[model samples]
Target: MTDTATTAASAVADATNLVPSTKAVRLPGAGKLLLAQIRYQVRLLISSGRAIAVGAGLPVILLVASKGKDTRPDVAGYAVFGLTITAWSTYGVRLVAAREDGVLKRWRATPLPRWCYFLGRILATALVAVLAGAVTVAAALVFYGSHFGDGPDTQLTVTAALAIVAVLLVGAFAWAATATALTSAIPTVEAAFPTLIFIYFPVIIVSGVLFTNLSEPHWLSTLATYLPAQPLIDAVTHAVRHTSGAPFLPVRDVIVLACWAAGGLLGAIVLFRWEPHRSTQRRAARIQQ
Candidate 1:
């Protein structure tokens, strides 16, 4: 019994002396992940001509379309509008599709933080949106003779910059929410486009993209201003119009945009699914088998 006790004590001492080996790991921070995501997204955009065409070609086309027309100043507004729509329709849809395909799920399962992943996507999307907007503005200036009489003043510039950031943040949140709702109900990626179109078209129409002023009732105009696309449109319009001592400051527009951003973010946080349907199905099948 003493020998057995000595043996156990020796084993315990040996076990205590044996330290568990740890693997050296390096995890990316939110900023690093954002940069990485930006690089990846830029590469993807470069590879696909869609981004380039939208950034470079579409502005030229719009310029040509608006030449010798009644709606010359409207061209700049339309260009910005198109950029916003493209961001929401194309990039937003792709982001959701990637998530639905389990790319996001796999990435999340890694040691890499989820906030890092989201930051990366947001960084990437913002880069693309800004690049596209800049190119469009340049085209509007060169080809369409469009000019903002006062070039980016302290107040106007600050407002415009803040408005652009607001548009991106709110737009991203809105897309995330819409994507969650669609993916939860619909089964396929192809269906996402239609679902997005259904939600976006009405907003775009009511946004006064085609018509600068709404012919509808005062309440309708007030209601329309609160919609996602309209507030952004109003912000863009204010930037371009830049009439000194203008009657309206677009306070309502900014508030509406903020509300949409907050609501969508809340919805997305509550509803977004990390796993793909296929993985869920396969796991269930294996469990049953």
Candidate 2:
């Protein structure tokens, strides 16, 4: 009986040794994860025909319509318009829709860090916005015969180029953050479009995006001076005109943009939500109705 028991124990030990041991599952590094997320977000943007059409194509068409126009104020305004749409459509409406659709909630349950996801979204938006701005500017230069400076003889200095690039990047990120932050106020995906348009159209009008804001009332122009779009347009105008020197940087505009960027980021952090405000039943009932 003792020999039989010993043999059984030996057989069990041999069987255990023959089985494969499980190895620990390793996750991708944070940097890799962030890069992957950014790529995915950019793909999502590119795949959306409406996003490309409204964000990129519209501004180019507007620029083409105003052929032979000056580069400084006119092209600058159109370029900024492209940036605004890029940021708003990419982050604002998209995020609100994602949250209402439970995509954000599902993301929350994933192994990906929340910060990584948000950062990736912001970066992707900024990148696309900057590209849109660049395309508008390039189109102006190529087809419109517009030069960077006030005159054809005025060559673009390294410093001025740097300033323009810096402003484009900063402005893109600022607008993106502002758009995403505004998503907090948007309760439903259905309300996102008209609500954003209602708010944005007025600001752009006052900011002189459509026509020159110069013709507007003093109070309206002053209010727009403190707003986001005007500053961006002002900065771009200055840079495009190659008005370089100590005061080349539009200090007031930059400050206002920086303030808006800071405020928007803070608001986003404070008001962010992972789940939909409306319940599933309510959404279904609304759908049925």
TM-score of each: 0.73, 0.81
lDDT score of model 2?
Answer: 0.78
Question: Can you write out model 2's per-residue Cα lDDT over 71-177, one digit (the tens) per residue?
Answer: 44377788888888778655688889999888999998999988788778887888778778877777777765646434664344567657766787778778777
lDDT of 1 at 183: 50
C-alpha local distance difference test of each model: 0.61, 0.78
Q: In model 1, how large is the Cα lDDT of residue 225?
A: 70
List ranges where model 1 is wrong by over 4 Å: 1-26, 52-60, 146-185, 243-249, 282-289
Best-matching candidate per TM-score: 2
The numbered model that scores best in lDDT is 2
Give candidate 2's TM-score: 0.81
